[model samples]
Target: MIAYVGDFGLARFLSDVPQTSLVGVKGSTGYIALEYAMGAKASTQGDVYSYGILLLEMIPGKGPTDDMFKDNLSLRHFAKLSLPKRVMDIVDPVLLEEAKVSQGSGNHTNTRKRMHACLISMVRIGVLCSANSPRDRMEMKDVVTEMHAIKDLYLGVRIHQDEQVMSQLSGEDPSYLSYY
Candidate 1:
């Protein structure tokens, strides 16, 4: 029995050697950035775009190459079109059910509304990270910050940033942003 206690990420990350620009089609088709397909240099933005796709896939339970996508349809577009409103329609049923089971008992409608707000924020992050232009995508630090905020909101546990709990909290009647 052998146990590898650490992550052995691809050696490409360790090797600081400059990769040849315009390398032909290096990554999986769906995850690869459009700029890469057009023979541009590999970049951090490309990785961010792929991560966005991955996040959307987990939420929606849809593969990038799912057959439902045709006539210029794409996983990105499918998710984008469902954002803010119609979001629950596309969320993974099992995940939604689990959410309903956990921390959902106090006023069903409000609970669902809170959950929807959290999910909408997450989807917006995904969409921002996967924008068609590399310049439009989020930087990794911003991504981490936003994700942590979302996590704090979802858990109902305050993550004190500057001694302030930063959930959609304003005044009385705690408002989840989705209600607006």
Candidate 2:
């Protein structure tokens, strides 16, 4: 549901077709595939790779930067090298809020535990989708499934907690907690 609009001038139209294609030997640079930069024909797979990058940007609130790929460092390389730890560092603080509320009561112990678990799952999915080898990356359908599951679980937990708070506010007996 997210869109990244880079310079359309960077996109070129083929003489024989109406469809536009990315220009320059390097395409858009930060999120482009190696095949695109190498002059191989761009495919949906290339777009999927860029979509993966876009997904990362949505979660982190920062698009890929030239610095991410500098010093022989590609985003994929950095993510893979760091895996769960450093990858979590780049996650947006918004997710931390969601994770905390998802855990209920906002207790530090519960929030930290839930956030850690959610973050780990998120990093795993992101890493899979952003694999350096396009063939190794997941299909869009699989990505959709995984993302849905994460959202469902996170929201489901939060909703249950909300119901509890509502019941308490209404002065309903706490014993009713078992029903929800």
Candidate 3:
């Protein structure tokens, strides 16, 4: 099922057509950008900020409005703090479990390292996209490119690993496996 994480009132009232600007700042509290709060008209940059927050939330499974985001701490801050250091600590338990299951009993270290690297890259994109200054934020096109690259990086490793496993089971050379 698809779930939305924005202003319910706007979603309920507004037409399905794309909107460039709204009458006023009307977004979910935590998802709204600082410029919007300061009376800046809604813009694509603002939307990018919100999308960044979504990415950050998705990986860690923590909403910006969660109780832990009090007293100057925010979803952005939480994610930024984790960085390349404590990514596993902030990542969702479900993702970790899924990784473990998919990894099976072979080459745990390599699978885990790849996972960590991908997680770091994802978090960095989110952080860049949600920068306080609109100019500093990553463009939507760039975000898309980065996301696809990360996906390819992870899946490329998985496909190679799967081919190796299949070859071992069938007593065939891994190099002779057909990628097509």
TM-score for all predictions? 0.74, 0.61, 0.74
Measured with C-alpha atoms, the lDDT of residue 114 in candidate 2 is 42
**Order of the predicted models by lDDT, top scorer first:** 3, 1, 2
Q: What is the C-alpha RMSD of each candidate to the true structure, in Å?
A: 6.8, 11.0, 9.9
33-85 in candidate 1: lDDT tens per residue?
Answer: 77766655666787788877777777787767779888998888888787656
lDDT of 1: 0.66
Better of 1 and 2 by lDDT: 1
Pairs clashing within candidate 3? none
What is the Å distance of residue 84 in model 2 from its true position? Answer: 2.5
| Ten-residue region with minimum lDDT total, candidate 3 | 171-180
Better of 2 and 3 by lDDT: 3
* Candidate 3 C-alpha lDDT tens digits along 79-147: 988865687789989878987887678777666766776787788778877889888888889889868
Largest lDDT belongs to which candidate? 3
Cα lDDT for residue 60, candidate 1? 84
Q: Tell me the spans in candidate 2 whose CA falls farther than 4 Å from its real position.
A: 1-27, 66-68, 94-108, 157-180
Q: Which pairs of residues have clashing backbones in candidate 1?
A: none
